[model samples]
Target: MKKWVLAFIAAMTFSIAAHAAIEVYEFDTLQQEEQFKELGHTLRCPKCQNNTIADSNAELAQDLRHKVYEMTKEGKSKNEIVEYMIDRYGNFVTYNPPFTLATSILWLGPLAVVVLGFGLIVVRSRKNKQVATEEKWDPEKEQRLKALLDEKNDGDKQ
Candidate 1:
């Protein structure tokens, strides 16, 4: 029917409209293309908390991708592009941020935690060992316990 054909056409149009358009960049060399892809994967999207610019669909991510592509075309080295992004977006933009005083805690916190955990475990085990040794039967205490049991047995015999 005519109504069915119109509905089908409308559905198709809407489906196409809902899909996002992909951007295509032209590179003179294969190395440039590889650099672009690598930068895309390396740079984090400021708008998307955990997604790389390559994986994010946010507008900021698109802008960053374009910037990276432009920098690549300009014959900039990968480190230069990364440093530019870091200067613009702070260390949060790069997945591998450099070690500095501000980031020292991030790099050292896990090791500190592991060391502290082992220390606590060692201290706790020593304490447990001490308690076990204290609880072991000494001759004086063993004699007292035997005396008490003998008294109880004697009373029960009555």
Candidate 2:
């Protein structure tokens, strides 16, 4: 019983010490800290599709977090840090990227899809209407068809 208790205490102590290895940087001011948190939330982890740098535990996310901290400490403004991230990782790193020729596709793609979908729907509806109109009753044609069928039936009976 004594040995088991000692082993449990040792394990707990080691676990606590191990968790202390994750170092969090301190900011000089609350405003700086808030800015850091805001930037982290805004910037995406390069390798993560949906996770912000603040929420991701990926190696790339860790690196980016460290870079943001270092830039903040060096008195870099939020826009400067954001520009640096965008420059390094392309437009994917930031949610609000500046308009550029390369990013035009992202802005215009949905509109193009919607217009194409409407055009296809219009064409299909027109085609269906034409087919429906073609099948409308024609008295003369129907009378001719009825006579032909009657003649065939009479020949069969004969």
Candidate 3:
């Protein structure tokens, strides 16, 4: 009975392993296969936070992979497949989205913020320097300050 249980467990493990096998795609030419792989790596999985389609195990990623395979088999150019994905899933589907007016903020916002911060620092620094220069002690003021300190020390001693 124990032998039968072990045998059943082993069979179940093998079945699960077989079921989890990596998906294989066939292409007519090596170029086509390379194109498919390139697209997979360049395309982001819509359902995942930041994983490429080639690295994601999401259902949407699988569907996208199958769609890419179908398109490749149909002799579609890489650009066409990319365009189709963009149209279907928006520019977020591509790791490197094209720069457009709508996406300009995404591409340029950091630089703008850095420039603004640097300008603010420069203005503040200039203001500080002006204040420091304006507050320079005159000789008369320094003499008066020393006299006051001397008088205070004399009174304390007395």
Candidate 4:
């Protein structure tokens, strides 16, 4: 039947469309595999936001993955490879940056924000707790209110 043929075709199409990604290399090369893993985690995907190239599915990620495979196979020192990438692409291409006087503010910015937020909340809560609610009514007005309420109650009874 046409229904059965269409169903089979649809299932095949869906399966084919799924990304069949897998690890490109076996674990037998212990030194190379470990280094690649570390390098992969360090390298940023040029086309993906904040994700390492190895963890991204972008075209640039694939190219970087190939680059890692080739570079590691050629026995380049890990530091040398990182320095090369940093030199070619600048610091933004990698997640980690060196610690210096200029970067001290960048590193401490989140902690400063949290401390400021907590201080603001404490100050606001103190302000809220300081609300004045007690009121002093004039003695003459209180007496007038009592007289009016008593008269209303007497009228309702009558």
Off by over 4 Å in 1: 1-9, 12-19, 136-158
Estimated TM-score for each candidate: 0.75, 0.75, 0.81, 0.58
Residues 22-119 of candidate 3: C-alpha lDDT, one tens digit per residue:
89999999989999999999999999959999999999999999999999999999999999999999999998889999899999999999999999
Write the candidate numbers in order of decreasing lDDT: 3, 1, 2, 4
List runs of model 4 lying over 4 Å from the truth.
18-23, 26-28, 100-158
Pairs in clash, predicted candidate 1? none
Model 4 Cα shift for residue 88 (angstroms): 2.1
User: What is the Cα-based lDDT of residue 133 in candidate 3?
Assistant: 93
Q: Tell me the whole-model lDDT of each prediction, alpha carbons only.
A: 0.94, 0.90, 0.94, 0.81
Candidate 4 on 1-158: residue-level lDDT in tens? 99999999999999987857675765447898899899899888767869997789888788877877778888887887788777776666678777667677888999999999999999998777766433456899899999987775654786
How many steric overlaps are in each model, in order? 0, 0, 0, 0
Candidate 3 stretches with Cα past 4 Å from truth are: 1-15, 147-158
TM-score (C-alpha, index-matched) for candidate 4 = 0.58
Best by TM-score: 3
Worst 10-residue lDDT window for candidate 2 reads 149-158
